[model samples]
Target: MPVASLNDIKAKVGADLGASPWIEVTQAHIDTFADVTGDRQFIHVDPDMAKQTPFGGTIAHGFLTLSLLSQMGAGVMMVPDTTKMVVNYGFDRVRFIAPVRSGKRVRGHFTLAAFEEKRPGQWQALHNVTVEIEGEDKPALTADWIGLIYV
Candidate 1:
């Protein structure tokens, strides 16, 4: 990711910020997420049982794919040179469009939807993101993610 001036970044509203490297969604990743979130649904942790479902095998939890935005964004997001800190400000919208089966690769595609100074030293940014599943026509999810940057 490149470090740019606030104005420079703001100029990129509506521009594609590129994509993160492909990351395989493993059964282990699903299990860990399920354990941590206490959402151990059979479809996510029980491969044999999951095989009976439409997905054919265990699928990653929706939140697991959503949470991966952090890792996915790191390689694609831009940082302001004067930024002091940045924090998640939640999402405007998020939709899980498809189930990511275990072993499938996924990556995020980001576009700068909005960027503006909300206060003297605070900036709010909105990124329109799509998490694409390798070899699949449909994406796993889409979200309008917001972030607060304090400089």
Candidate 2:
């Protein structure tokens, strides 16, 4: 969806939401991320060692799950049009609610939390994102993220 001005986007305070798209977390993906982040902990890198943990097998890193918010949220962004360059501004709150075990599918449910003007041609938006595990009671991650847009 196209971006919108702060004022225009504000009208969507009670916007209807779209369904989340599911994504599978694979061992290969986790290994790649571990290599990228230089965080090759056994819980996330060694399947055999991870088996003894409550999680049963190597799990994807919390940050890796958090990073998928954008893709899952893409189908849920409410802005209709009015800006360019929507960049990752920051996060308000972030929590790793549950372990994302490898081979499990996770999805994100995005809800617009707030939108305000930061400048004449710039705006900031807050999204409350919940990433749920395919069959788990607890969500894998929950975070309030910010995005900055320029007209």
Candidate 3:
């Protein structure tokens, strides 16, 4: 709900283990990303070529999918106070355990993994983000996202 205290944060921790703003990985999205990142790997940019590969089709880049975590998990968290600011802290034990193929819809599940006080007005939170790929047995991605909230 609002900015939670170090202790009050427990209630919000491990909360919202879900997804929102569902998105589908399309050839177009992948192509644009390839243009931006100069990563026009056949597996990610060419559907025909990728189809012959192990994954069977072009897949979204792991980083591109990971980049959507916050967007997909939107409304799942907030700092209640207007004065509070949230800054990305970093990641923990991040791993791309699976592939997100094109044409697949994906969403994120936000689970508060841990929290700690940084200072009198700041706190750090670690969230376990599980991104699932629709119709896939394995999740597209899993990462521990950290953020610093200033109250």
On lDDT, the leading prediction is 1
Candidate 1: segments with Cα more than 4 A from true spot: none
Model 1, global lDDT: 0.95
Per-residue lDDT value at 11 in model 3: 64
Q: Write the per-residue lDDT of candidate 1 for residues 1-151, one digit (tens) a residue.
A: 5789988998999999999999999999999999999999999999999999999999999999999999999888887999899899999999999999999999999999999989899999999999999999999999999999998
How many residue pairs of model 1 clash at the backbone?
Answer: 0
lDDT score, residue 112, model 2? 76
Q: What's each prediction's TM-score?
A: 0.98, 0.91, 0.88
* CA lDDT scores, all candidates in order: 0.95, 0.84, 0.78
The positional error of residue 69 in candidate 3, measured at the CA in angstroms, is 0.7
lDDT of 2: 0.84
The lDDT, on a scale of 0 to 1, for candidate 3 is 0.78
In terms of TM-score, which candidate is stronger, 1 or 2?
1
Q: What are the RMSD figures for all models against the true structure?
A: 0.7, 1.8, 2.2
Query: Lowest-lDDT window of 10 residues in candidate 2?
Result: 1-10
Candidate 3 runs further than 4 Å off: 1-8
